[model samples]
Target: MTVTTDRVHVYADEFDEVSRILARTTERVRLELIDGKLRSKAVPDGDHGRIIQWLLRICMQSRPELFLHPDQGLKVQAYRHGRARPDASLASNDAFVGQGEWADPGPVLMAVEVTSYDSDTDARDRVEKPRAYAETGIPVYLLIDRDTCEVTVYSEPDGVRYESARTVPFGKTVVLPGPVDIALETEQLKDWVH
Candidate 1:
């Protein structure tokens, strides 16, 4: 298997163990297994944290029944072999109850990612995550691109990929379609981007 980082090839189970160990050892690193490759997710900066906070507040107000979960690890991709920790996961308040570090994606209504300033952000967030989430049958994948100051809503997952994608600039409003039905007023997002 081709590795994304450090040229270390490991099975899915092995990656899980390594991730668990790392989680306990340090909060400085986060790992993910996608497309049979190991990858690292950068720690969020102040702006990244603020963006998640902004979305969390809006989600709570508009859809109190659902909660925005941060740093949620999920078993994704076809057959659930791939594991990913999305920036935030939108689901019922108790969706992840009784689950371990990596939960099944069945209860997830949406997976959110805010781009970081890392070099791998383009491949990891913009390309890989959408495909992984879609293949896992998650209904929505929300991408907040800080680099370009745009929000891309991906929906209608057909098990291989999302069939529809709508992108709007920072100041406009975007609707997160069914299952995660909420209109996001993104004018505030402008303040959070670089």
Candidate 2:
């Protein structure tokens, strides 16, 4: 069950054990298996937390039938040895009505990521994740880039990357089309911190 990458090793079916071991530590870390590598990061900062909350609340109010899940690990069929834990997710209520820990991307409407301070974090949020999510057939990938002080909604997945994308600044409104069409108010996304 070992998935070997260039610089890291991950066990495909050992996520539960790994999570259990990591849970004993004081640091709040999230883990994902991608491209046969184990990727880990500390839970986002307070501002990121607040924004996720805002998005969740708004999504709930806009579409009551769709459930907003925050920081839940998604088990995707596209990647054999990967789990994607998006910042926030919009999915049908039936997707997890009687589910357990992990979620399948089949019923997922969109995935959201709030970029972090580090360059690697930013790259993953901006580049790697979007491509992977699209390849998995997730309809939308919403990226809130802290460094750029902007939001990008990537849609029209073609099994490689998004065919369409829209970017807007902090003070503008970003419209999410199709499945969960809603205009997001981004005036309060907050400025980038040095």
Candidate 3:
């Protein structure tokens, strides 16, 4: 679940400092800056980790050059002021080399987020992330919605938002479009959701 305080505005630099301190102090939580708001992301559960692993295997098999980097922090949104930690960032090997805690979203081919069973999942994963990733011009954004048991692929980013979004059930096949051209046989996704 995300803990957001709309009343208190946060700057990117302040958020960065806090995020770094959080990283150094603990591994129990992750902090994100979205729309100038400070939000905390929950640690993934066992099933969430398994789903990422499953996709990692598929990505390696299909496109050996790209690696699915888990929990990669990215600078997203307009002016690149917003910070986001995607579940998995699909990028070429060594894309994040020499970069600090948060890397530029330019090299990211796709940003992936798996929904956690939380009240804010709809607003955070479905609404906010899509806009942030798109504004950063990330080619695609993949949302694995465990709540709905569906995979939504948002692609063809037009700088403001993705022009297309295709959703498929857990047992169906979904194609992650170009830049991330891989066909996923999501039948196995059924095993990962509650």
Best by lDDT: 1
Give the per-residue lDDT of model 3 (tens digit) for 107-163. 999999999987778988999899999989999899999999999999999988899
After TM-score superposition, the amount by which residue 3's alpha carbon in candidate 3 deviates from its true location, in angstroms, is: 12
Scored by Cα lDDT, where does model 3 land? 0.90
Query: Lowest-scoring 10 consecutive residues by lDDT in candidate 2?
Result: 1-10
Clashes of each: 0, 0, 0
Error of 3 at 9 (Å): 2.7
Off by over 4 Å in 2: 1-11, 24-27, 77-79, 191-194
Per-residue alpha-carbon lDDT of candidate 2 for residues 98-142, written as tens digits (9 for 90 to 100): 665567778889999988786478657877788778888899999
Please state the error at residue 179 of candidate 2 in Å. 0.5
Q: List the residue pairs that clash in candidate 1.
A: none
Candidate 1 stretches greater than 4 Å from native: 1-9
lDDT of 2: 0.78
Task: Report the lDDT tens digits of candidate 1 across residue range 64-165.
Answer: 999999998998875538889999999999999999888988999999999999999999999999999999999999999999999999999998999999
